[model samples]
Target: ILAALSFFATGSTQTNLGDNFVLGLSQAMTSRSIKEVTDSMTEHLASRHIRFPNTANEINRIKEGFFLKHRIRGVVGCIDCTHVPILAPAEADEDHPPIVYYNRKGYYSLNVQLVNLLVNMKILAANSQSPSSVHDSAIWAASIIRTNVERTFRKGNNIWLMGALLHICRNAQPGTPEARYTLRHSQTRNVIEKCNGLLKMRFRCLSKQLLYHPIRVGKIIYAAVVLHNLAIDFNLNDLNDEEPLIIDNDENVPNIHNNHDVLNEGSRVRANFIRRYF
Candidate 1:
């Protein structure tokens, strides 16, 4: 069963898996079994592995890890979105038109939001419910993790996740605080990039166009994320011979609303952060 799962995850089709010497079953049977096993494993494993810190101790441990490793304080995790390619849906309803899945990259995909601990490379949350047409910022705004963090802040917890910094001044003097902050911020955020790359590299199916329905593809993604955490827990060797292909939607610029109050607050926070840390 494990071998079959690995084969299935590595992009082998049901027909191919069924034709294998080990399986030797019909394609229909293989497909049915795969779905059953995937759903079962995801349900059991996701509950155990794929989740954010809920308690004060757990949250502080993650923040300490970030501060120790990256010199970034109060960072519990890093958040980013990655595109998972899927076959175009054959039918569409009014709520979900066909074009909704067609991303700016000219392919059908699901925009999956992943938040992870950078020090240990453990996925804290995997949200695969958004269509590719959804902007990353919109997804971030609606994310449960974001809401939880906000609620925690209101309670004086003051923990947060690192996200993309828009419009860093690249031409700042090399030794200036702005340049120093940019350098450190980019270095710290690179963990998310490596995390996404490692995920696709390990689960080859994610790199390929998933041939399942969008919903099923989402399940596969979740299952893969669970397996990824397991692999990390077991200290499995990484597959780094080849770089994973990460398809990002360059056109999906985050929509920043024209709210002067919010803008001023953000600028104030950033300046203070730079002055204190950089």
Candidate 2:
């Protein structure tokens, strides 16, 4: 069942899975059954695996590793948001309009965020079900992982999470401290970008609009992340033989809300990091 779930979650089509089913047990699995098993496996793997470093010592190790490998100081993790295309709800009411799923890219999707503490590009934590229309920063503000990040900092830990330029910077002039910081930040943070790219590449299902309901679609996305982590842990690096399929629309630009502190904190952190390191 785990093998079958992996096969399907790793971008195999239902028809192919059914055709290649392994005899007796294979006879029992319909498209629906495949989804159920995959979702269950996702729940199991996510609960059992996907560990994020919690202690200050653990976080400090990650920070030191980033500084040593990438010369980016104070960064313990790289964070980024990706969109998972999904079909609009079949039945929409005033409370659940189709527009709820229509993102700025003019397509329906779920704005999923992932954080990577490991350099192998495995996700340590994810927020996978945010509405596509919501800004990336807004999703971060509401996420449990963000709460952890804040707590880690408030403890005088001084750990930072590296994010893309747009999310962290606004309009600093060229040669400015903010500009220099953004350059180094984006370079080190490319791990999340590659992680997201390879995720969509390995699970081609993410490169297209899923036919399932949004809720089930989110489950499938989570399953893919879990499987990706397992592949890394088990040393299955051969999965990237083919070139990754590029999703046409990139991540949404943050629609800055009235939450002024989010932006302020981003600027403050970048400035401090630059003055201290760069």
Candidate 3:
């Protein structure tokens, strides 16, 4: 199973896998069967390996890591979205049209959201269920991680995931606190780009167009994420020297237009952060 999974992650076709393995295996295994295996592996591995910090100690460790590495405090993770190219869905029906999978990039894809612990480049949350047509902000608003973060905040926990803040420092003087904060924030948030790039480089399947059902493609993505974390655990270094892709932020600034309270709170937080750190 591991061998098959390794081959899958490395972007081997089913025919190639069959040629390498036994005939009985060939007769039993189809693309759908492989997807089934991948799904099972993803679920099992994610349950065991991918987890958000729930305890104070675990949360503090993550915060400490961010502070030590990026000179930024209270950042538990970095969040961003990456598009995984896929073939247009053949199974599209009236309710789920094929055009829905077409992204702004001129291709069919899944807009996958990832929240990674910048300190270790380990993914804390991954959401591959949204189609390419979905906006990143909508995906974020609908994410379970966002819900959990809100709940945690209500309970008096004040941690946050780092996102792009370049807009805030726009046109500001170079030596100003806003400019300095933006510089650090960009440096810190860049880890997610590296993580996404390393993940695709490590798992060749992600870098290429996945020729599978849209649902199966999502499962494969999850499996790749699990394997990526496992590779990090094992200290594997099979990635190439290619530059990691920088994921473009659909919306860099937080949306505070709808709620004055949110705008005020964010302003207060930024002011406090700049005053104390920048």
lDDT per residue for candidate 1 within 91-207, as digits (tens), equals 745665668899887899998998888898789998887899888778988888888988887888868677663335467798999998788777866667888877887787887
**What would the per-residue lDDT of candidate 2 be over residues 75-166, giving only the tens digit for each residue?**
87787788888888756455546787898778888888888864677788877777788787778878887788788888887877777533
What tens digits encode model 3's per-residue C-alpha lDDT throughout 1-278?
A: 74456555667676666666553356236454676778787867787777888888888899998899898877788888888888887653665567988987688888898888877788888888788888667788888888888888788877877764223555768889988988887776666677787777777788778877778888888888887788778888765557555444433233446877766776787777778778
Compared with the true structure, all predictions reach lDDT values of 0.79, 0.72, 0.75
lDDT of 3 at 250: 36
lDDT winner = 1
TM-score for every candidate vs. truth?
0.89, 0.84, 0.84
Off by over 4 Å in 2: 2-13, 19-28, 93-96, 165-179, 240-249, 257-265
Sort all candidates by TM-score, best to worst: 1, 3, 2
Clashing pairs in model 3, backbone N/Cα/C closer than 3 A = none
Indicate the worst ten consecutive residues by lDDT in candidate 2: 21-30
Question: Could you tell me the C-alpha RMSD of candidate 3 in Å?
Answer: 3.5
List runs of model 1 lying over 4 Å from the truth.
92-95, 165-169, 238-252, 257-268
The Cα RMSD in angstroms, rounded to one decimal, for candidate 1 relative to the true structure is 2.7
Look at candidate 1 and tell me the lDDT of residue 199: 81
- Which pairs clash (backbone N, Cα, C closer than 3 Å) in model 2? none
